[model samples]
Target: MRLDKFLKVSRLIKRRTLAKEVADQGRITINGTVAKASSILKEGDELAIQFGTKVVTVKVESLKETAKKEEANNLYSVVKEERVTAE
Candidate 1:
């Protein structure tokens, strides 16, 4: 699955466009390397997404074309979440 689609399907981001924008801006990383919106996603891949002051890290668990609201959380497992504010 594409990184943007995985983000949306996993509910990490609200929309695909925003995911793409974030990725394009170099706010997302896969395994410590910068990733693009069209980056490929695979099981067990770790994604670190920057959202304003919060950094959300998740490991890809599964991939599907679509998921129900109840099942959305199963797609990825949040490994760590950190909040970094300006000093």
Candidate 2:
């Protein structure tokens, strides 16, 4: 699945367009490298997303074209989440 679509389908970003924008702006990383909106997502890949000062890291658990809200969390596992502190 595409990174942007995976983010939206997994309910992480809430919208596909927002996810695409974020990816395009280099706020999204796959396996520690910046990823574009069309980046391919695969199971077990690590994804790090920057949202303002907060960073969220997760591992892709599954990929699906469509999933119900209740099953969204099954798509990825949160590995780390931290807010950057201004120094």
Per-candidate TM vs. native? 0.95, 0.96
Candidate 1 structure, TM-score to reference = 0.95
Tens digits of per-residue lDDT for model 2 on 1-87?
999999999999999999999999998899989999999998999999999999999999999999999999999999999998766
What alpha-carbon RMSD in Å does predicted model 1 have with respect to the real structure? 1.0
The parts of candidate 2 lying over 4 Å away from their true place are none
Question: Lowest-lDDT window of 10 residues in candidate 1?
Answer: 5-14
lDDT of every predicted structure (CA atoms): 0.93, 0.96
Q: Relative to the unseen true structure, what is the C-alpha lDDT of residue 7 in candidate 1, on a scale of 0 to 100?
A: 89
* lDDT score at residue 16, model 2, on the 0-100 scale: 98
Residue 1 of candidate 2: its Cα lDDT? Answer: 91
- Residue 47 lDDT, candidate 2, scale 0-100: 99
- Tens-place lDDT per residue, model 1, 1-87, is 999998898788889999999999999999999999999999999999988999999999999989988999999899999998888
Q: List the residue pairs that clash in candidate 2.
A: none
